[model samples]
Target chain A: MKNAERKRWCLEHAGEPLTPEDEAYLKEHPEVRLEVERLALMAKLMSLKNHEEPAPHLETRCIARVQERIQSRRERGWLYRLEDALTLNSAPVWAAAAALAVLGAGLWVTLHTPPDAGVAAVQEADPGMPPVSLAAVGDVQPSVVQTSPAVDVASADREIPLNEKPILFLRMESNQLPHNSDQLIYGNGGTMPVRFDY
Target chain B: MIDPHPPDAAGQAEEVTDQELVARAQGGDLEAYNELIRRHHRKIYAMVYNMTSNKEDAEDLTQDIFYKAYSVLNKFKGDASFYTWIYRIAVNRTINYVKRRNKRAGLSLDDVDLGIERDPAFLELSARESPFRECTLTELQEKLNKALMTLSEKHRTVVVLHDIQGIPHDEIAKLLNVSSGTVRSRLFYARKALQVELSEYAP
Candidate 1:
């Protein structure tokens, strides 16, 4: 190649492994040789000038960051393990069987419970029953249930409408209790007798 | 006749193998990963700092590169050296970052953040030397960087990789996923551009 072409080739291949032909051309052509030498020198100068060490704190920061990522990966690994264990192929069929057992027990309890008379009374009341005070509406028969003046004072802070019927309260165990018992509480406004120790 | 056996052990020991370190790292050796970083961090930083021209962004990008490498350690097949793989990641990320910034900033290639006149290191160099103080090499470097900015990212990256980092063209091609011919042509144009820009630096 001519000088200009050889110089162009040298620039093009600045950091490449030189072919024997290009090496021979540079040996033969003084101008191409000078250009090659200058390019190498310039490359070295630029590399030296721009060769920067990473920031002093980068190693520590990178280690900390990598450790943080590793910790996250560990946490994620546990989740993945859980996923694998819970997958259809990996999980035992016993879990489904256990779920069926609990559901069956729930259904059994729901079917066996007898209906309450107070509940049936409230539920199937002669719609014509006289509207009683919020505190006086209860399990006692209308003939025996007296509206004492003292009862109104205790629950007076709440507005208990005269027309409201007392609702039966269920205990924590889901058993129905009369609203008047101290253990069971009348909510909104109906009273019924329910007895239990606090 | 068999070719004379190359000196294997000492030649191999002279340079740290990224594959070995990566395999060890994947096997849960944290120190191996640290060694990997120690071996490659400077080159990675040089690439980032040249692209960013700011230490802060360079440091952040360097961290991102290694963090990404660490996260994907299991996926690294030995087709490329870990150096080439991470270098490609760094370059691709930087190019994407610049592209995204260009989209938002509406800035052209000529307007990359090559930093300002008062960068402390360059300024310190300026203050200490008489000739450099008279007409600072930092100023000259800035001028060169500005000229570099005028080139497309592809060409500028070629110059930065081949010229500034002294990385070989074949390895650059591997990292850039370009033909060696393409590397050669781009390098020619990049050097020509740089020479015209840096002519004053030559005696």
Candidate 2:
């Protein structure tokens, strides 16, 4: 039999009657005898269970301590509860949640906040520039825009300094964004609000 | 008003299960929790004491573990037996404490030697004419405790639980969260090391 199997058998049958086969195995592996002797000593030690009989009233004292802790826990219950709420046991989970919230807010602001930086600066820098009405574009016919054979880039570009441009005010109440993505008709460059004729 | 000390009905009624007591305790029943403590405190205390070899540390730790179990009783899902749950807590916390303290002054086997004179099992061995028939036996017991101290906490824990505490190998496996084979292997190695260390006091 293997050493482990022999050890297992000897342990299982320690201090009990052994079979003839087991006797033959132990006789052959004399080294396992010390293991069996140690087993006997352990059994003797096991019999002395009360050797460590806890100091009298250990249970009563421990229970008293538990009650004290529970009482204290109750007395400062709110602070204990607040600590529990803020205790970051799962740091990664809270970190991921916080990161996702910040990312979502950034995306919302980017997608919803109007591109008003240039317009705001233009108004703030030159408060006297007359607010141009978007309705004025209605008077300039579309044909006039089409009939201009080739636009003079220098004149359009020189008419306004990059920092000093007129602001156009348009009023609409739809939460739905208008599909005015055709930038050629309504493009604004930096502070300059491109004129529209339509 | 709740009874400060409930009757020992749990002990008298064999059918009163730990699960039932746990359920009651979960509903803010302190009396039921007291019964649970009555049933398991000694075993928990002994396990901690054996691991730490310090009675004061064991006392404090046992109280802490019981109170911890009470504080977190609501989280007990009742899938595993409460004994297994509490034993696991006791073993883990004791092992952690042992590793942190990393010192030894244990078990005072000297006390065991003095206590076992009246024990029938030791009497059987004492009946034999042995070398220490005239000795104080304190040195021998001290040697034994020192030998036990030589073992790593993991090895000593197996010996303490299985041999001294009379816990079975399978239950120990569950409590230590290890395999049965691992438990047996550890016990075998631990017993062998201890025997070799104190061979002069051999049975």
Candidate 3:
């Protein structure tokens, strides 16, 4: 038979039952019969050639490796979860706190009051005569300290500054102010004594 | 027909399926998996060695095949025997290794050590054939093994599994991850190629 014809026949019957005609043909054809015998021989030889015993320690090694993998998973599971939770939620909270602190400090400086740089300069330039305490320096006479409270002014004299824009200084005698122990100087006709504690 | 026997009957038994063993190994059951490795390691090693033509590489590739099998054990289902699944892994890995080796060493499948000359089976093939008795055993065996190795990997594997290991076409299809038709085609071509290669020595 031609090579193509033989190949087609072999392929057609490879896993299936051979037709009686094809079987008889194979039995009669010396070349085809020899090849079939050779194939069967080759199969047996290949089987014998490749039957090696596997590594004796292969089983032990595989088991040990698997155990190690499981142990690692157990150890890392909680840590990974904690890391993920921290990553997902905690970063924004810290960021917001920092942002709020920055905002509050900015608002205090802008809306409520500015630092008294001007008052500090004035105090530094002044000489003698006990630089006029804002309490005594106010439009009200320092004598008003006596009429305002039971405590005398001389015993409780202290200086304080008020008004952030064009800064004012203050001094007051000991007085039982409702809000503050140190009295703050008030302008004429003002009832409240803004206490200066320091 | 030869009767099929269990590969081992004396050992302490493992109760899990191969897929279950792989799943347990994936989930951390080393002992369960070692049973799987012990069962199929030789067949995997043989398939790799035959294709690569080197013992050390075959050993390394065998190790790698099992490692790959272990890592992906969770993906295994019971659709095929563990033997077929690992056989596919062995064949694919060996083919890839051959391709890489070909690129690096500038060698082809013809260069591998096939041990055909040392084989004792030649005495049986030339038996009672009416002529050609004077040919040296080494010469005939070398010619045969060389012819076998020269076959393409696709054909070689089918021949090895079916002709050599006596695996059935359906089993081969499962191992190669192809249809029985494909296996049949490959076997036919492989056998034809071997016959052509060996035709000069025939009576």
Candidate 4:
């Protein structure tokens, strides 16, 4: 064997006797034998070094520290989970805020807009009043006035007055009055008379 | 009424397999883990002590290693033996710690144990015709530790693991995450370096 390999083998197996190949190599190269012996001695010395005794409380202290770590982790479990859930990539918080904003806007629109405005507009468009000519009032018989749906023909027939100046009878119901006055009007352009039906 | 068990109960407890204890410890059994600590703490402390040569640092590092091992016990797959896994942790932690310590200060040797003179190897060496026999045990230990500190961290680790700790090359390779050939080469060079450093003591 080569001298370097022989020395390495000797150092590696310090307690064992050299093989015939190593003995032959060492005999041929006595210079490397001293080096091998020194390494063997060093290894023996290193092995003989005493094993140091650790502190008596080392195990207890370690166990206590580990327990403390485990307990602290348990106590902060929810906070850590919450933090993980609210990370920027998750988007739960932003999604919830957006949903709340949409619901609030819907509630505001539902509260402020009147529900009966459409019905009021339809009523104003077709008020159920029939066409009546002032000149034909005298010529109109009760039967002709009865054909008008909005006139309340029976009430109109009893109130019609025949005159050369053609009086128009406009009936105002108590609920329809803007100023809480229930009155009928019968008159010409400038001079008018207010007649209270009640 | 308290029932008395045999006094050898602690001795029997020490005989439990590392795998059994590891299983129990993984299930949150504190006693099982403490038993493991009792069994292996000495060897682990010795390994770190040899690397650092400082008893206080070795004690603190040993505690830190056990605490870290317990914290990550669940991650340990049964592929390696429990002792091997713990050994890996102890070695790696000590290596990192030594690196950080090296940056701050030079290596220092603690007082040698008085019992070293009684060791069989020391007696055999003292009987030889060498300068090692001339110095006192304390002086020899200090010189050996100083020589060890002179080596690079990688070389020192290989030597400690293979030569001092008597770990097999294959096992040392696994712990170091290197091939067995690399471990052998490193061990060879490390021993060669030590032989050169301690040549005066050679016969």
Q: Candidates' TM-scores?
A: 0.51, 0.63, 0.51, 0.61
Which parts of model 1 have CA positions greater than 4 angstroms off? A1-7, A10-45, A73-198, B1-20, B29-31, B103-134
Q: Judged by TM-score relative to the true structure, which candidate is superior, 1 or 4?
A: 4
Over 4 Å off in model 4, which ranges? A1-17, A55-198, B1-15, B104-115
**Candidate 3 lDDT over residue span A92-173, tens digit each:** 6568778999999998776754333333334555532233343333344445444445321221233422222222333334
On TM-score, the stronger of 3 and 4 is 4
Q: Evaluated with TM-score, which candidate comes out highest?
A: 2
Stronger candidate by lDDT (2 vs 3): 2
Q: Model 3, range B130-162, lDDT digits (tens) per residue?
A: 332566544544454566668887888787777
lDDT of 1 by residue, B1-203 (tens): 00011122224445656567788999989888887776667667777777755566667777777876776679889776676677777888777665544422221112223443345444544454334456544455566556566667788787788777667778778777899889878877766666676665433
lDDT of each: 0.59, 0.64, 0.56, 0.65
Poorly placed runs, candidate 3 (over 4 Å): A1-7, A10-19, A27-48, A51-198, B1-20, B103-123, B126-145, B196-202
Docking class of 4: incorrect
What DockQ score does model 3 reach against the true complex? 0.10
TM-score of chain B of 4: 0.85
Candidate 2 C-alpha lDDT tens digits along A55-165: 778889888887777677778988864453344133565787799999999999878855444444445665554443333444433443444333221111224542344
TM-score, predicted candidate 4 vs. hidden true structure? 0.61
How do the residues B2-57 of candidate 4 rate in per-residue lDDT, one tens digit apiece?
00111213465557777788899899887888777777776787789888877778
True contacts kept of each: 0.28, 0.39, 0.22, 0.42
Supply the DockQ value of model 1.
0.11
